[model samples]
Target: MITNLIKTFIELFGDSNEEICTFFAPGRVNLIGEHTDYNGGHVLPCALEIGTYALVRKTANPFIRFYSKNFPETGIITVSYDDLSYQEQHGWANYPKGIIAAFQQLCPIETGLDILYYGTIPNGAGLSSSASIELVTAVMLNELFAQHIDMLELVKMSQKVENEYVGVNCGIMDQFAVGMGKRNHAMLLNCQTLEYRYLPVSMNDCSIVIANTNKKRGLADSAYNERRAACEAALAKLQKHINIASLGDLTSEQLEEYKHLLSPLEQKRARHAVTENERTLEAAAALEKGDLARFGELMKQSHISLRDDYEVTGTELDTLVEAAWKHEGTIGARMTGAGFGGCTVNIVKDESIPSFIEQVGKEYAGKIGYEASFYVVKIGDGAREIAEAKEMSV
Candidate 1:
């Protein structure tokens, strides 16, 4: 894939071999936590082996050119550094454009760039593809221009690009996991405080299988913002009676005690946030204790909360999880993202992955009238340039 991308880059724009640089940024999957980041709750997310790649070179002109293999119909998008505003016609390039716009605020980009992007992540599958692209752009710029921005600062800038530029109110978990991921490990992040620690992921005989429902979701167009609003309203109601900054600050018991303060919908939203936060912490501990069963049970509980309280899991996602539950080799399965429709992260015995995929895929297609995709992914390192490799061969 790297060689092909490099070849494509040369084909698109005449390349100066020495000036070319390659970078990768991985997509993230939240193991347990869902819709908890903006609520100031905990999230356990790990970077997937699949993500976005960029082959870029500095250009003499102020005009930036972009291309993506995944969206060939869009052709090459050209924009000037002076005009980095979002352009609907540019399609997915807006993600990188948003990052460029945000980065320019901190420091001037004296030179324009020609970039070729290719992503392995399934777009709109609740994997952090947008964030993956954003971080890749940030890291590419940081390396190419010698901008010595800290990684954490770059993570924040990526989030800012999504929130302020792209107009999607996202939390730091996606960007943080993509930027700071370590191999074979998951990050336990405090969304409110930004305090995090890496927990080793010892799946042993089990594998992390991501099953895509193939139901695309546009976060901004979905009920994602509404959910955030509901949580905010619930927090406001709780604040009237108790002193708490966010839903994360309260224990499950505390939330139950104050349940009467909020409307029924708001109460359910708050309960998911509070309980999911607690579950995330416990899940981390369970992993540390090498208790996969406990962790799997927490994953099941998370799906129920998301379905009943959060209401993000629709029929497609529920079908996949339900099918997974009926499989004997499956340890746990749950919708991993903001939910309306995306992928479910499942822990299954390595030997049973084939049967698990066949059975689940059959069940899902039978119910949904469409096929779903499955990937057995590995935990990988964060975004960085490839110094030794000339091309990326996915």
Candidate 2:
């Protein structure tokens, strides 16, 4: 991936591109719990090497011209600093335009940009590509204007654009992880308080292998909202019997104490979230102590709850997890992102990753007949300045 970036960077800079700054934001991979983010629960996620890069230069004209390498198309949108709106002709540009809108809210803005974006992260693969784009754009604008916004603040602004403008009710996990992830570590984030720490990720002999299910998540569909609403209902019902505000606060025993107040199905969903949050905390500690086996056990249990209790895992996702478990030298496997089909996160022995990929792909192909896309991702630094170029001369 770094070699490919070096090739593209040389190409982009070799041409007459003016003075440019390329901002990057990483795609995140959750190590453990799935669908536990928005419920005010704990999730272990790290920034991926796969990320979005926005190559931009200051423009003389009031208009901003946008080009996408993925789409290989050009879009020219004229924006008035007086009032910024293109009448909702939303596309790849909206991700950047939303950042401009946020800048305008705080103070007077000076300039627009001519942006050429080339991204490698798979779209709709539960890898948070959209968040990567939004966060990187925000970082670009910040450096360009010297806005000096803090890290978490930038994460919130990026999230707001996705939620209010782009329309996705995602939690802070993706944005936060990408915005603040440390190299060689996973973030132990407390969603309720917005405080986080980098938990040491000991992948000395293991590889974090991701298998994309080739299925897209229909988050706007009923399933996503249904689970969210179920958690809310459980909180409301449990509040009468317990003093807790959210399921995040309730103990495992406490959750069971008020189980009778909820429908059998809702209780199961709520139970999974409460326990999963606990597992994430324990898993973080296990990783810190270099106890991979204990952490692996937590990941395996996470998949079971997501499948049986949360009811998010589909047959393909389940099959992928099962295949990884059966493969020797695999520590743990679970479905990542908001289920209904996305990717499975697996921790496999570094030497065995190749065989595990081949075997899993071959067996899954026979069962599902669809080829799975594998991504071997590692923890990378969060968003920051690209001070010195990577020696662009050929």
Candidate 3:
């Protein structure tokens, strides 16, 4: 894959002799936390080996040329280093453009370059493909130009690009996981304080399975913003009765005491954020104690809260989770990501993976009238330049 990608890059830019560097940023899957990041809650996410890769090299020209193997139709997007402003016509390229525009404000860009991109993650599958692209761009520029930016700062810059430039109002979990992930580990991140620690993921007998529902949902246009608004409104109502900064700051007991202060809709929204935050902490403890069963149970509860209180899980995501739950080999199953129509993260015994896939796929296809995709992924390190280009996959 690296050979092919490099060959294509050379063919496109026609600069075989010039120095080219390979940079990668992995997509992330939240193990338990959902819709809790923006509410100042904790999130458990791990980076996957499969993500976006970029082949970049400096150019003498004044304009930067961008090309993607994934979206060949977009052709080459040219932008001047002087003007990195967001352009609607840029489409997917806007993600990288946003990062460059934001990053250039802090660091002085020296020259233009030609970049070719390729991604293994399924687009619109809620795997943080956009975040992967953003981080990869940030890392690439940092390495090529020696920007000396901290990893956490790069994560923040990526989130800023998403929220301010892309207009997504997203939280920092995606970029944090993508930028700071470590191999064979999962990060427990406090979205409020930006404090985090790495927890060892020792699943010797089980595999992490991601099942995509194939129902496309765009975060910016979806009810994501509305849900954030609801949580904010709920927090405001609770603030009148009790002093709290965010929903995550409230405990389940405290929310119950002030439950009457919020409307029914606001009550539900607040419940998910608070409860989900607690569940994430419990899930981390379970993993640390090597208690997969307890961790799985927390995952199931997280899905239920997302379905009932959060209302982000649609029929497609629910169907996948329900089917996975019925499987005897399944330890726990839950809808991951922003919910509407994404993927479910499941823990399945190594021996039962084949049967689990066949059975779950059949049930999902029969009910949803479409086949869902599955990938057995392994936790991988965060964004960095490959010392030597290599093939990437699960």
- Error (Å) of candidate 3 at residue 164 is 0.4
Poorest 10 consecutive residues by lDDT, candidate 1:
385-394
Better of 2 and 3 by lDDT: 3
lDDT of 3 by residue, 1-394 (tens): 7878888887898864567789999999999889889999999999999999999978778888999988999999999987778788998999999988887888767777899999999989999999999999999988888889999999999999999999999999999999999999999999999899999999969999999999988989899999999999998877888888788899999999889988999999999999999999999999999999999999999999999999999999999999999999999999999989989999999999999999999999999999999999999999999877733310
Candidates in order, TM-scores: namely 0.98, 0.91, 0.97
- List RMSD in Å for every model shown: 1.7, 2.9, 2.3
lDDT of 1 at 260: 89
User: 1-394 in candidate 2: lDDT tens per residue?
Assistant: 4345545644543444456666788889999856667777778899987788877777665766666667644444455666656345656677777777887788766665667676778877888888888888888888888878898899999888877876767788889988997898898887777777888787768989999988866555538777888888888988887787678787898877779999988899899989999999899888988998898899999999999999999888998999999999799899988888889999999999889999999888889878889988888988765655433422
Backbone clashes in model 1, listed as residue pairs: 1-393, 2-392, 2-393
| Candidate 3 residue runs with Cα over 4 Å from true position | 390-394
What lDDT score is found at residue 379 in candidate 2? Answer: 85
Q: Please report, as a residue range, the 10-residue window in candidate 2 with the lowest summed lDDT.
A: 385-394
